[model samples]
Structure formats: C-alpha cells, structure tokens
Target: MFDVVVVGAGPAGSMAAKTCAERGLKVLLIEKRQEIGTPVRCAEGISKKGLQRFVEIDRRWISAEVIGAKIYSPDGTEVTMAEEMAGNEVGFVLERKIFDRYLARLAAKAGAEVIVKTTFIGFERVGNALRVKLKRMGEDWEVETKLLIGADGVESRVGRIAGIIKTLKKSEIESCAQYLMSGLDIDENYTYFYLGNDLAPGGYAWIFPKGNGCANVGIGVLPSIAKANAKFYLDRFVEKLEIRGKIVELVSGAVPVYGEVATAVADNIMLAGDAAYHSDPITGGGIANALSAGYHAGIVASEAFEKKDFSANFLRRYDELWKADFGWKLRRNKRLQEFFLKLDDETLNSLARSIAGKNIREMSIEAIIAELIKKNPSIIELLKSFLSP
Candidate 1:
C-alpha cells in the first residue's frame, strides 16, 4: 500500500510525487503512456520566475530564451511590450519532452515509485483508506492508498470518478492546435501574439520561437464563438505571417479555463493541474500553475498522513492553499478574458493604435490602464482593478 498515489506523469503529477516522497511519504506515480512525455500539446513557454520556484532551469530543455512579446491588432498594427509591462511573457520555450521526463526523473530520485503504461481505472472507498484499480498491459490490479491525487489532463476520468465535477461546459474550454514549423524567417527572440475577431474569435494566435529556424505556431479559440476549428485559424495565421516552412510536428488539445473547480478535494482525494482547471483564463497557460498547485497538494497530502486524517474535511486544506496562491489571480484574469471577448475588431485596432510608439518599460500597470482609459473611457470601469498597487 502506498501513502499517496499520483495519477498522470505530467508536470503536476511528477511534482506532487517528488514533494510527497521528499516529505517521507510512500508515493506511487503512474502514467498511462509508455513514456513520460509524448505527443506534446503545450506551447511549452514558461516564465523563468515561475519555473525557478520549483525546478532549476535546465539548459538542455530550453530551446530559446525570449525577452519580450509583440502584440498585433486586427488591422496588423503591432505593439512591442517588455515583460515589465505585463509581468509575464519573458521566459524559455522548452523542449517539453525532455522537460517532462526530467521532472519524472527527479520524482524517482526522491524515492517515489514510478510506473508507466498503467491506466487508472477507478477507485473505491474502503473505510478510511481507498482501493485503487488499474489496468497495465492488458492486466488488471489494485493498490490501496491513503490519499489519491488526480493530475490527469482536461479529460480527467479521475476527477469524475472522485465525484468532484461531472461535466465541463463548452464555453469553459479552449480548443487549441499547434505546429512545429521549420525554415521560418522571423524574430527568434520575441514571442508574437496576434489578436482579432477574424484571427481567432474569442481567442488568439501565438508564435513561440524555438530557435534554430523553427518555432511552435499555435492558436486557441473559444469553441462557442469559433466559426471554424482551431486548425483553421492556425493555418490562416501561418499564411498571413508568410511562413513558407515545412511543418515538422502537429499538436492539438483542449484546455480548461473555467476557473478552479468548485470542489478540488473530497474524502482522501485531491485534484491538481488541468484536472482542477488550474489553467490561466487569459493566456490558457497551465504549466506554471500546475507545478505550483502540485507542490502545494503534495505538502498537504503529506500532512494528512502525519495527522492520520484522510477525510474530506482534512483534505480541504489542499484546496485552501491552492486558492490562496493562484485562485484569486485566475478569477481576476477570467473577468479580464470575458471583457476582451466582447471587444470588436475595430476596438482591437484602436487599442493597438493608442499604444503605438509608447514605451511600456517606463510604464507601470496603473499607468498603462490610465492611458487605455483615456483612449477608451467605456472600459475604465472594467479595467480599473489593474490600477491597484
């Protein structure tokens, strides 16, 4: 029997296992795939500040280190902003396969039992502990665990089985598609964001450079508002950028941005990462949050063992810690995303025009909001919180 069983071997699960094992818990980490990281779905860009909090920056996994971002309007007006303006976007685009495997290896080094090609079928409550069932290589087996952590991605069967959330709405998820293209002549230092209703209804397209004449080009769209699929928008973006390159890889997936799930923990179970809908609402980014939440969940899970209290009430502390760290920021970003979705193409163009030739590095969040308020008084009330010191 294991003290904690972490499902999925992504950033969240591996971090959780690592932390739990480091805390002297008997941890078991399992992955359904034969390998830890395969068929990458992420844009693989993570801020240096956020990633450094957990794992040390590994040069082998870093494809490129970016300095700033370029935001484009529907009419093709461009605005370049340094990380100082937004507190994000300055980071490294990762070789996700190597990065993911590295984290799993760290977990193994921490004394967590790592298993692959093992699928978590379901679980059953047995008095104070839980009986976890799994299928590996066409065989079924069971293991008992004091606590269970569901770090599975958006289509999380573990959360469903745990009775946390039953259904995810269409509006709550972003449809995404990406490609690794080669031989592209573009700025390899700055990430580019293209915004407009025509470009991606209720969403945006991005070009995250991977250096060596290649980049991960992708788009995310609100499925409810998108006339066509995410791939349609991504293809158009590639054409508009004049990226006459050979497609090297294709990746696609859905990301949950409905804010945190109402219930993240229940009776000996906790959810982290995409399973808990920890993705950023505005950017659709989850790796940083996943790592953060996973670390917190692992700490809390270890405490549950020390106290010998695995009930839902005891596990609720996990949810509280997660909320304290990232829940509030995500909630605020969700409101911002909703406001942006209401913007028309003309408004986007005008917004871009207003910020053109401005030095964002010298401006703070409050100052930027003031400038935007002057250009568009109607949005002042909605964006006033940005002025908060």
Candidate 2:
C-alpha cells in the first residue's frame, strides 16, 4: 500500500512523486517503458527561469543556451525576439533523455519507489483508498494507494478511465514530428520558427539549436486542417533548407492544445501534465507547466493526507491552486492561439513584416507587439481583448 501511486515517469510524474515523498508519503513512481525518457517526444526547449524554479541549473542536461528566437514570415522575412522577450519556449535546449532520468533519480532520492517497465492498468475504488492496478514484466500487479496520479502523455489511458477527457477532437491535437539533425549551418544563439500555411498549415516549423551544428528541427500541424501529416511537412521543410543536414534522431507525438480540463481532480485521482491538457495552446510547450503542476500536486496530496480528506470536494483545492498558478495564462493563450489560427498566410506575413527590419531588438515583448499594432493598426481589434487584463 502507498500514499501515492504516480503513473508515468516523465517530468510531471517524477516531480509529483518527489513532492509527495518529500512530505513523508509513500510514493510509488512507475514508468511503463523499459527505460525512462526514451523515444523523446518533445522539442526540448524551456525557459531558463521556468526551469530554475524546480532544479538547479545543471550544465550536463543542457544541450545549448540560446539567447533568443528568430520568427520567419512566409515570405522569408525575419523578426527576432530576445531571450527575455521570447517567452517560455526559448532560452535553453535540453538533453531530454538525460534530463528525464535525472528527474526520476531526484524522485528516488526523495524516497519515492521508482520503477521502470511497470505499466499502470487502472484502479478500483476501495473505501477511501484506491486499489491501483499495474502490470510488471508482462504480468498483472496491484498496489493499494490512498491517491492516484495520472501524469501520462496526451493519449492518457488513466485520464480516460477517470473521465478527465471525453473525446479529444482532431482540432485540439497537434501532430508533431522532429529530428535531431547535425552538420547544419545555424546561428547557435537563436532558435528559428517559420510560419506559413503552405509550409506547415496550421502549425509551424522550428530549429532549436543544440550546439556544434546540431539542432532539433521539427514541425507541428493541426490534424484537422493539415492536408498531410506532420512528418510530411517536416520532410519537405528540411529539404528546402539552405543547409543540408543528417538526421541523428527522430521523434513524433501528439500534443494536446485543449487547454486545461474542467477539473483535474475527481475523488482519489488527479491529473497532471498532458493528461490534464496543460500544454500551451499556441506553442504546445508543457515542460514548465508540468513541473509547476506536479509540484502543486505533491503539495496538495500532502495536505490531503494531513487533513485526512480524500474526497473530490477536499481535493478540489488542487484544481483551485493550479488554476491560481497558471490557469489564466493558459486560457488567454488559448484565445490567442484561436485568433492566430484564423489568420491567413498573408495576414501572418504582414504581421511578421510589420516588425521586420526594425531596431527593436532590445524592446520588450509587449513593445514588439505595440510595434505590430503601430504598424498594423487593424490588429488592435483582433488582439486588444487578449492584451487587456
């Protein structure tokens, strides 16, 4: 029996387990894969500040420290945003395989029982505690716990059984494919994003530098509007690149842009990371949000145990807390994402063109937006709502 059975050993799970265990709870952290953090699904970019909130700045897990981002319009115009202005998707590219392992090790260090190659099947209600089901080494297993945490990825089975998501519409999913490529000529200081309907349809292509002529080059496409799959656009984009490169690694996955769920809590169960649709609606970035939500989950789970209340009404504090933390940002970004998606390629080009060839490198992100509004007064109508509190 355990105080918490956190399924999936990704960033969210590891942090959840670690947080609970630190509070003296018996946490069992399980990863279904033979190894944790394999088959990398992320583009591996995170903000320096967001990352530092959880872990010390470790050079070992950092692939490269980027200074900023370069956004390219469909017509090939470039607009740059400095590190402080680029938001959460810029700053550092990570060696995710190592980073994930390090996080799991931290959970272990915190006294969580970490196990790999162990799958979470489901759970059954038994009084106030839950009987967590599992499969180890291809055989069924079980562990009774007071709480269950679903930190699984986008297609979360645990979330499904717990009724966190009903139907994930195609419109809410970003089908993404990425390749770790080397032998490419790239400005190591800046990550690059290219936008165009022809290039990526509803999504965009990116090149996040990883030092020494290597980068995570990828594309994400909204499946509902994409004529072809994500990999199809990725391949075409790579071929058209000015510099040829060799693929060192490849990864593909679905990212949920469905924003936050109605509630991430139900009785003895709670959801985190992609399971709770915590990825940013515009950028599909979740590492920071995962770390934040996981930490809160741990705190809330600890409080639940202390109060001796496991009911949903009691656990609703987790929902309230996460919402207080980053809920408004997610909701605002979702609205921004919706607005951006409605824009045609020409409108996107014009927006980028408005800021191109400017001496605004030192400007704040808000200033850059103001420049856009200054140049394209029409945009004020489209973005005023999001810009205002």
Candidate 3:
C-alpha cells in the first residue's frame, strides 16, 4: 500500500509527489498519456512573480523571456506595461513540454514511482482507506493507498468520481485555442494582449513570444458569449493581422476561470491544481497556483498519513493553507474581472487612454477601483461587495 497515490503527472501531480517523497512518504504518480506533456494545451505563459515563488526556472525550459506587455484596445489604443516599472519580467513564455518533463523527473528523482499511459478508472473506499482502480496496456490494476491526490486537469474525472462537485458554470469556463507558428515578423520578446469584445468576447487574445520569429498566439472566450469555436476567433485574428507563417502546432483546451473550490479536501482525498479550480479568474493562468496547491497538498497528505488520520477534518488543513496563500488575491481578481466584463469597447479604450502613462503594478487595488468609481458611481456598489469588511 502506498502512502499517497497522485493522479495525473502534470505540474501539480509531480510537485505533490515530489514533496511527499521528499518527506519520506511512498508516492505513486500515474499519468494517462504515453508522455507527460505531449499535445500541450497551454499557451505556456506564466508570470515571473508566480514562477519564482515555487522553483527556480531553468533557462532551457523558457522559449522566450518577456520584458513587457502591450495591451491594445479595439480601436488600437495601446497601453504598454514595462518590466522596469513592474520590477519583474512580466512573464516568460515557456516550452511546456520541457518544463513538465523536468518536473516529473524531479519527482522521480525524489523516489516517487512514475507511471505513464496508466488511466485511473475509479476508486473503492474501504472503511478509512481508498483503493484506486487503474488500467494499463489493457490490463486492470489496483493500488491501495492511505491518501489520494487528484491533480488532474480541467476535465477532472477523479474529482467527480471521488464525489466532489466537478461541474463548472458556463461563465466559469474559458474556451481557449492556441497555435504555435514560425516565420511571424513580430516582437521576439514582449508579449501582446488584445482586449475588446469584438476581438474576444468576455475574454482576450494574446501573443506570447517564443523566440526565432516564432510565437504562440491564442484567444480565450467565455462559453456563454462564444458564438463560434475559439479556433474560429483565433483564425480571424491571425488573418486580420496578416501573419504569414507555418503552423507548427495546434492546441485547444478549457481553463476554469473560477477561484479555488471550497471543498478541495475530503476523507482520504484531496484535489489540487486545475482539478481544484485554483486558476486565476481573469488571466486563466493555473500553473503557478497548481504547483503551490500541490506542494501544500503533499505536505498535508504526508502529515495526515503519519498521524494515521485521513478524515476530512484532517485534510481541511490543505484548504486553509491555500486560502492563506492566495484567497484574497483571487477574490480581488474576480472582482476586477466582473468590472472588466461590463465595459464596452469605447469605455475600454477610454480607460486604456487614461491609464496610459500610469504603472498599474505600483497602484493598489483600492486605487484602481477608486479611479473607476470616479468615472461611474455605479461601480461603487460593485466594489462594496469585495471591499466590505
């Protein structure tokens, strides 16, 4: 019997397993894919602030290091936020395949057993312990574990089968599509974001530099207002930009825009990463959050195993730990997303023009909201919900 069985060998699963293994706990990490990071679904951009907090990123894993970001309005009004003002690289567009494999290797080196092409079918609870069911090479297998960590992706079957509410509301899901292309004559370092309903309703389009005239261009839209597939919108944008390139890769996926789930822990089970909805509501970024959550979950799972306590009350520590780390920031971002979604093209353009020379990072949340409230007093009521003590 293993001390902990981590499902999915993504960033979260790998981190969790590594953490547990480092604490001398027996860990088994399972992945359904033949390889860990093939058919990469992410646009591969991550904030430098988030990445530095967990692990020191190796330069080889980075496709390009971005120094700044340019936000464009529908009418082409642009606001450039530079790294000099933010005191960081804004973010790095990474080669996820290399990054993910490196994470899994770290876990394996820490003594966790890594298995690929192994699909988790379901689980059977036997009193206090859980028996995980899996399939590999058309053969059925079972692993009995003291704890289970679900680090699965957005479409998390482990959470559902484990009896967690896995349903995401229409507005909470961001339908995304991305393309890796070469021979594009664009900035090889800075990232670009286009914000406007006409370009991407209830979401945005991005161009993350990948060096050597290559880039990952993508768009995300809320399913509630997406009249066409995300790919359709992305194709239209690329055509409009008159980009001449050969498509090196095509990726399509969904990201949860909701904050972390309230019930990420249960008896003998815990959820982390996208499976637990630990994604940024506005940016649709989860890698950093996933790693953080995984690390906490791993630590908690190990402690619970040592205590021989796998009850929900014991596992609840993971929830508290994650909230202490990111709950307030997520809540603030959610409020910001609500305010942003209500703005039309003209209002957005006007706002962009107003904030043109300002450094957004230097401003506090209250300061930014105050500016918006001055323009529309009705925003005061919305801000009250988030600001209320």
**Which ten-residue region of model 2 has the weakest summed lDDT?**
359-368
Overall lDDT per candidate, in order of appearance: 0.87, 0.87, 0.85
For 1-389, candidate 3 gives per-residue lDDT tens digits of: 99899999988999999999999999999999999988798988887887888778799898988777777888887766664643356678889999999999999999999999998899999879999999986799999998999998898888888777568999989999999999999976578889889889989998888999999999999989878889999999889777788899899999988865668887899999999888888878889888899999998988897888999899999989988887666767777787788889998888777666654442123455555566667657766775464
lDDT measured at residue 16 in model 2 versus the true structure, 0 to 100? 96
Cα lDDT of candidate 2 equals 0.87
Q: Which ten residues in a row have the lowest lDDT in candidate 3?
A: 359-368
When 1 and 3 are scored with TM-score, the better candidate is 1
RMSD of each: 2.9, 2.5, 2.3
Candidate 3 segments exceeding 4 Å error: 85-88, 359-382, 385-389
lDDT score at residue 296, model 3, on the 0-100 scale: 96
True-structure RMSD for candidate 1: 2.9
Error of 1 at 51 (Å): 0.5
